[model samples]
Target: MATPKHDLPDDDIEYVSKTEMKREMTALQQLGEKLIPLDKKQLATLKLPERLFDAILAAKKITANGATARQKQFIGKLMRDVDPEPINELLNKLAGLSDRHSAWLHRLERLREGMLADPKIVENFVNEHPSVEIQQLRQLVRNALKERELQKPAKAFRELFKLIKQYIPEPALPGLEASGPEEEDEE
Candidate 1:
């Protein structure tokens, strides 16, 4: 086999092997697949390009296996131009699979348990987060305990966790800008 002639020197020529290119495209396709099931609220949070977002939405509507696979590959081609770090971070967060998010959830679980075990345990949260409503927190703890005793569905139990999550927000993941509900444009 003869090598193709080129003006650039061998060292100046940058070539990506077919194997590596295929690997990258496969990874992008997997990422795009992950985006397909996300609800509108979750998808709106990402800074995805319009074309890629539309492709994801379209992929959601495709029911045939072959068509879905081809659409996913098309999405991979579009992802080549987009940065993926933020998307991965947000997806991890939504899934609650990130280390920091797991720890945050565990902490909230512990807090919920403490509140259920002792109503006075809420003072800990009050001291730590002044925004917590004392009455609401107490009511939820009471309702959760009642649910536990009565062996009913954990409606209030889950609500108790939501309340804690609301008052004590998750810390921002490293390398991502943290935006609070009240964030304003800086001068």
Candidate 2:
């Protein structure tokens, strides 16, 4: 038998299970699937290689089930040569601020503005969200008004927004359970 050619000992070679490799391949395929739905402009942002970009475009066009599966597998194989971290990071950044999330933030801003504009809005806020500490809310509002009058830093104003966030739950994604910090828990 031929002696081992390399310097490293045979015993030092780390082994990976077949199952782990398959799991990684599946994840890559799923990531590729996400890229497929994006328009050409969005795909351009990823700067994929010509072969991989063409493969993705072809995958988008295929309707036959078996052919689509094979194309997806090919894309997964191509993805193996690419660094997925940057792709995943970019995809996550793109996914983060959905329209719903933006609208929710705007609503919170409007609520804060309304409270500042009208004392009655504070009462309405308290009534709408009974879980909040009424005394703390009022104090924060008063302090925020005083800060505005004195031209001081808007510490209480920002704090009031934080308090409101703690009380109001973020809008849930469709078909998914709402996952945020417990509303009753004081931070």
Candidate 3:
């Protein structure tokens, strides 16, 4: 059998012992398995470096008196490289704030602004969906226009609308459960 080629320089190859090579091979095999289905674009977007990986691993190891595994993982990522003093102060200040739809409204404004920029696309959409409420479509376009001018991208707004559509109760879609007979009145 032919000798196996070492990609590294002779000096570097000599510096890495056989045990190191075996360990590296195992790591590569694991990485390949984890990454097989990810396309180049998805891989590029991960932005994971050695420091990020190390930070995540380190975060995973921190345990408090009653922290769960999921909570530890969440706090680890959220707290990584964050300063505690100012964050605590901010949290204290915002403690009274309710999780309302206001933030989502802001996001919707951003989406509206983006849609207005592409007039042709908007026109085409309207043409395609002639039965859709013209006033509603106009409102959507106007909101997108406002968001773009404010320098907020429309993605957040679009996401907010998508979430609303998904979560908010709607008149049942076609072919869903039919309205049944009303229950008899009890004494």
Task: Give the candidate number with the greatest lDDT.
Answer: 1
> What residue runs in model 1 are displaced by over 4 Å at the alpha carbon?
1-15, 64-66, 116-121, 128-131, 142-156, 173-187
- Candidate 2 lDDT tens digits, 1-187: 9966999877999889999999999999888878888777656666688888999999999999999999999999899887786566556535764566556667877888788889899999889888889999989989989999999998898888888887776765443334444222222
Superior by lDDT: candidate 1 or candidate 2: 1
Clashes of 1: 0
What ordering of candidates by TM-score runs from best to worst? 1, 2, 3
Candidate 2: Cα lDDT at 156: 90
Worst 10 residues of 3 by lDDT: 178-187
lDDT of each: 0.80, 0.78, 0.44
Candidate 3 per-residue lDDT, tens place, 1-187, comes to 9999878877765477899976755554333333323343332333444443444445445566355344444434444443333323222223423223234344444444445566665566557656655666666567655676788877445643543333222232122232222121111
Clashes of each: 0, 0, 7
- Better candidate number, 2 or 3, judged by lDDT: 2
Name the candidate that leads on TM-score: 1
Write model 1 residue lDDT over 90-166, tens digit each, in one string: 77876657787778778889988998887567887888888778888889888989999999998889888888877
Model 2's alpha-carbon lDDT is 0.78
